[model samples]
Target: MTGREFLEPDSPQQRLYLDGLKRIEIMQKILNELPKADQNLCYQGSYFLAANASLCGLAANHFFRNILHVRKAAIVSALPMAVIPFLSTAAVYDVFVREPLFSGQLNCEVCAVVRGGLVGAVVGGLYPVFLALPLTASLAARYSSSPLPGKENLLRFWLSVSQPVFRKMSWAVLVQVLTGLYLATKHHGIYVKILQQMNTSRDPEELKA
Candidate 1:
C-alpha cells in the first residue's frame, strides 16, 4: 500500500518522512539561489580551509613567541612565508577534491575524508619547513659577516629548528584528521536517515520491488 494509505496522517513516521523531504527541498532551493561564485567557494571548502589555516597560524605563533622564546618581530616577518604555502595547498585541494565531494558530484564520504586527511597532513608537514625558514634566515643574518664552516652545518641548523616545530604541530594534524572524520561520519548518518525516510514513505510495492 502507499505511504498515505499505510501510515496514519498524524503518525510520527509520517511526520518524520515529510519533514525530511521538506528539508531536502529547502536545501536544494537555497543552493540554487546562491550565486555561482559563492556556491563554488562553499562547495570548494574555502571556509574550512581558511579556518584551519588560521588556527595553525595562531598555534605556530604561540609556539614561536611564547614557548620557544623567539622574538615577535621575527614571527611577523615570516608570516608571509607561512601563509603562502597553505593558501596554495588549499587552492589545489579545493579545485581537485573538496569541490567535487561537497557539490554532490562525488558521493563517497570515505574518499572525501581521506583526501581531507591527506591535505591536512601536507599542511601539517609544511608547518615545520616554513617555520624553519624565518629562523634559519635570522641565524644566517646574525652570522652573515662570517662564512659558515660548511653547508652541512646549515642543514643541521635547519633540521634542529624544524624537528621541534614538527613535534609540536603533530597534535594539530591529529585534530584536523579527527575533525574531518567526525564531520564526514555525521553527514553520512544524516544522508542515510534521509534515504530511509524516503524509502519508508514510498508505496509498499515499490519498496518490495
Candidate 2:
C-alpha cells in the first residue's frame, strides 16, 4: 500500500498499528533499564537500518564506554525494545543532535521532522501555523463564553487532550518506513531488470568489438 493508504484511519489494520504505539513506549522503558544488552540490540538494528554501511554500532560502543561521553541519546538508542516507528526525531538523530530529554519539556520545534532540506523548510514554516489554527480556535471559543472560570478549565482540557505530542511522531515514522520498504523492494527489482536488458541490448555495437 501507498503511504497514504497505509496511514489511513479507515485501514483494516489501523487498530493493530495504534496498539503498536503503546508497545513502543514500553520498549523504551525496558531498554533504559538494560543498556549493555540493549547496546547489542541497537547495533544489530542500526546496522540493518544503515544497510551495513559502516561500523557505527562499534563507534557508538566506544563512545558509550569512555572516549566520548553520552549516557544516553534517546529511547531509540537506549532502548532495545523501542520500535523504529515509535521513536521521535530525537531518537533518529545521530551523535550530532542532542539526545532525548526525559524532562517532558519539549519545545515544539524540537519535535518537528522534515524529509530533507526543502521539506524541512516547509515543515518549519507551515506546520506550526497549520497546527496553531485549531488550538487557537478552541481556546478562543472556550474563553469567549459567559463564565470565565469554566472557560479556563475547558482550555486545560483541550490542551491536555488535543496536543499531538509523541503519537504524531510515531505516525510520521511509520509512514516513512512502510512506504520506503515497499518502494525499495519494487525499485530494486526494476533496476536489476533494466541492467539485464542494457547488458543484452539489441542496438549495442555488438559486431564492432
Candidate 3:
C-alpha cells in the first residue's frame, strides 16, 4: 500500500485527524460560551483547559487504571476526564472574569489571585514532563547498560504505585484555586462597599474627598 492511502476516510490516520478537528471545535465552543472579558487572552484560556485535560487524562490512563484494576474501568476512566475540565474552567474564570474586574497591577488582590492561579496551572501542567526527563534518562541508561526482563511488568508496578506522586502535586494546584476564590470573594465585598458609597453620596466633590 502506498503512503497516500492513509489519508482515505476509513484509514486510521484520517480518523485521528478528524478526531483532532473535533477536539478543536469543542475547545472553540467552550471559549465562546465563557464570559467575555477585556483581559482574557484566547490562546491562554484555551490552553489552560487543553493542558489540564491532557495531563489528567495521562495520569488516569497510566496510573489510575493500574491502581483501580476494577471491572468498570471504562466508567472510572471518565472521572479524570470530566473533573479536569471543571478545574480548568475555574482557572480560566479567575484569570479572565475575576482578575479583569480589578484592572490594576499585580499587587491588587484580584489581580494577584488570578495571576497566581494562572501560574499554578502552567507549572502543574509542566511538572509531569519535568519529572519524566530524569526518569527517562535513568531508564535509558539502565536499559543500555544491562537490558532487564519483564520491563512491562515493572512498568505496571510503577503505574500502580505512582498515584501518590501526582496526588502531592494536585494538592498544590488545589491550594492555588482555593486562594483565588477566597481573595476574589474578599476583595469583591470591599469593591461593593466602595460602589455603594459612591452611589449614596449626595455630592460628587464630597465623594471624591
Candidate 4:
C-alpha cells in the first residue's frame, strides 16, 4: 500500500519499495509532531538519528552481523542509544559552555574545546559496550543475523602479546609511575586552573592573574 509498492513493477522491488515507504511514513509522522515554532534543532537531531538507523540497521547486516559476526538481535536499537550521548554532549557545548564560559577569551576557549573533544572521545570509545551491543540484540532480532565474534579471538590476540616476559605487569607499574609523576608536576596544575575558573567567585577579569 506504500508508494514504493505502487511504483515498483517487479515483485522483489515491490517489497523493498513498500518496506522503505512504510518506514519513511512512520518517520515523517514522528517528525511532523515536532513543534514548528522551534524545529531547526529538532530537525537536525532527527536527521542524525535517521542516518544512524540507516547505517546501523537491518540494512547493515552484512557489515555488522555477517562479516563482523555480531549478534543478530542487536542492530535495531543500538544506534540511537550510542549516538544520543555524543549528540547531547555536542548540543550542551553549543548552547551552554560556548555562551556562558568562553566569551572569546583565548585560554577559556581552548579549554572548552579540549574538554568537549575529550568527552566526545571517551563517549565514542565506550559506546559499543554501554549502548550499541544491547539495544540491537533486544529490539531487532528478526532483522539481525547471529553468532557474534567470540571473545576467544580477542583473548587469543591478548595472549599472544602477553606471553612475552616484557608484556607482563611490570610495564603497567612503570607506566603508572610515569603517569603519577606527570600528573603531579603538570596535569595537577592544569586541573587546578580548570577548577578555579569553574568554581571561584573571582570576577572573570581577575582570572588573567
Best model per TM-score: 1
Cα lDDT listed for each candidate: 0.55, 0.33, 0.46, 0.38
lDDT tens digits by residue: candidate 4, 65-98: 3333455435334445445644654454344333
TM-score of each: 0.53, 0.24, 0.31, 0.30
Order the candidate numbers by lDDT, best to worst: 1, 3, 4, 2
Q: What is the Cα-based lDDT of residue 153 in candidate 1?
A: 87
Local error of candidate 1 at residue 168 (angstroms): 1.5
Model 2, global lDDT: 0.33
Worst 10 residues of 4 by lDDT: 179-188
Query: Superposing all C-alpha atoms, what RMSD in Å does each candidate have to the true structure?
Result: 12.9, 20.6, 18.1, 21.7
- Candidate 2 lDDT trough over 10 residues, lowest sum: 95-104
Best by lDDT: 1
Off by over 4 Å in 2: 1-176, 202-209
Better of 2 and 4 by lDDT: 4
- What lDDT is reached at residue 23 by model 3? 39
- Decide which is better by lDDT, 2 or 3: 3
lDDT of predicted model 3:
0.46
Clashes of each: 0, 0, 0, 6
